[model samples]
Target: MSQEVRGVIARGKGAPVEVATIVVPDPGPGEAVVRVQACGVCHTDLHYREGGINDDFPFLLGHEAAGIVEQVGAGVTDVEPGDFVVLNWRAVCGNCRACRRGKPWYCFATHNAAQKMTLTDGTELSPALGIGAFVEKTLVHAGQCTKVDPAARPAAVGLLGCGVMAGLGAAVNTGGVTRGDSVAVIGCGGVGDGAVAGAALAGATTIIAVDTDPRKLEWAKGFGATHTVNARETDPVEAIRELTGGHGADVVIEAVGRPETWQQAFYARDLAGTVVLVGVPTPEMKMPDLPLLDVFGRGGALKSSWYGDCLPSRDFPMLTSLYLQGRLDLDAFVSEEIGLDQVEDAFGKMHHGDVLRSVVIF
Candidate 1:
């Protein structure tokens, strides 16, 4: 049976998100219906509202979420009703070229619910990141539901569904940050702080956090940054280099998707060090000029992380365990708890950098 639930939707470009009645269908084969318990307010939600992601108007926003499986469809043995799960965007197709190569993290084909969630008048709505989780209940592929420790707080661990996971994976998976490595993360938002925390978890000796916002820099410290650089006052590349014994960091993770930040990340790494771009850039953005020789001279891996190269099946459970054990401070990321109607206001606070994440609690 189809169910009607309250959900946040972006009706048009630059439109203020509205709480609308979304019709969610029963799970089809390989699908599941989740009763969302908590959903994080991510910048991507705002991007969708601004039409920065695509021309798909009337988008059902909110992807970073944690919930309980309410129902499962045929052939869905991976999850069942009553299971606590963190919703993920990447539901890898095992036969994809990347998956066949044993890198499911790079799986080109991911899964979403075969059915669409629509509005009352029967207008189809595009779910943000393939998981329109802001609703009271949502339909998604069974593989999108990764069961985690039930004891973990939904508002905190739900962040692993998106931004937090992206940052951590940027450092640990993409950058290959390791023990004693010098790592610098540009952009001290939730994603950058996750990189900081991941670097710490990886035992990186020096974790340098670079950000223009002083408050964000302070937040970075809580995530285990060894040093903070105010990029607005100092050249980030030079500061990062100076902090790393004037040799640059072993890995530079760019969480801000701007061209200037990318260049800073490029110049902030040591020779043969890794540079991971985890930030989402706007469609109109372009890279600045760089000499071809410089790229060769740098002699390091320049990789773009799609969803932090995270394998939700593996990372979500492990990260949630760490969070439950208090090893990962996932709770620090939630600055406020809100209701469904406050999503638009949360976007404003996020735009002003007032909070790391304003999670909606059901």
Candidate 2:
């Protein structure tokens, strides 16, 4: 039976979101219905509400979520009813070109619930990231539900579904931080701080957190930063270089997604070091002029991290176990708990740089 659930919806472009009753359909083939426990209020959710993602109106606005699987459709085996799971946007399709080459993380085609959850009037709603979860229940492709340790807090562990995971993976998977290496992260937001923590967790001796905001720098320290540099007060590239004995850091992560910060990351790394761009950039933004000689002289890999280049099935469970063991401090990311109706106000806080994450608990 179709069930009515309360959810936050973006009615139109740049308009305020509202709490509405959405009708969640029964599971279709290769799909599952999850009873959402908690969902994080991320910048991407705000972007969807503001129409920065696309013109898709009446968008279901939450994605970073954890829940219990309630039902599954035909041919489902990986997850059964009552399994605790983190909802992931990327549901790897085995037949995709990337997947065919044995790179499931880069799966060219992902799947979502075949049936759409609709409004009371039968208007189809677009789920943000193909996993609309800012409600009591949500429908998704079975592959989108990655089972994790039930001992972890849903609100905290669910964060691995998005920003936090992206940050961690940027360092460990893409940046390839290693023992005794120095890593400098530009922009000390949740993702940037997560990069710092990931570097520390991966045994990088020096983790430098750079940001314009002093408050965010303080927040970065709690996330395992070995040092903090206020970019407004100092040239971050120079500072990171000086801190790393004048050779720059071994790895520099750009998490601000601006051309200036991208340049900073480029110039703030040691020769043959990695530069990982995990921040989302605007389409209108243009790259600064670069000498062809400098690109050749740098002589290292420059990479962009998409969703942290993570494979949900492999990373989610490992991260959840780490969270359960207190090795990963996922709880620090939650700045506040809110109801679904508070999404708009939470967006205000996000805009003003007030919170790390305001999660909606159902």
Give the number of the best model, judged by lDDT.
1
lDDT of 2 by residue, 50-80 (tens): 7778887889889999999999999999999
Question: Which residue pairs does candidate 2 place in steric collision?
Answer: none
- On TM-score, the leading prediction is 1
Off by over 4 Å in 2: none
- What are the lDDT figures for the candidates, one per model? 0.95, 0.92
The total number of steric clashes, by the backbone 3 Å criterion, in model 1 comes to 0
- lDDT (Cα, tens digit) per residue for candidate 1, span 209-293: 9999999999999999999999989998989999988989999999999998999899899999999999889999898688889
lDDT of 2: 0.92
- Give, for candidate 2, the lowest lDDT window spanning 10 residues: 281-290
TM-score for model 1?
Answer: 0.99
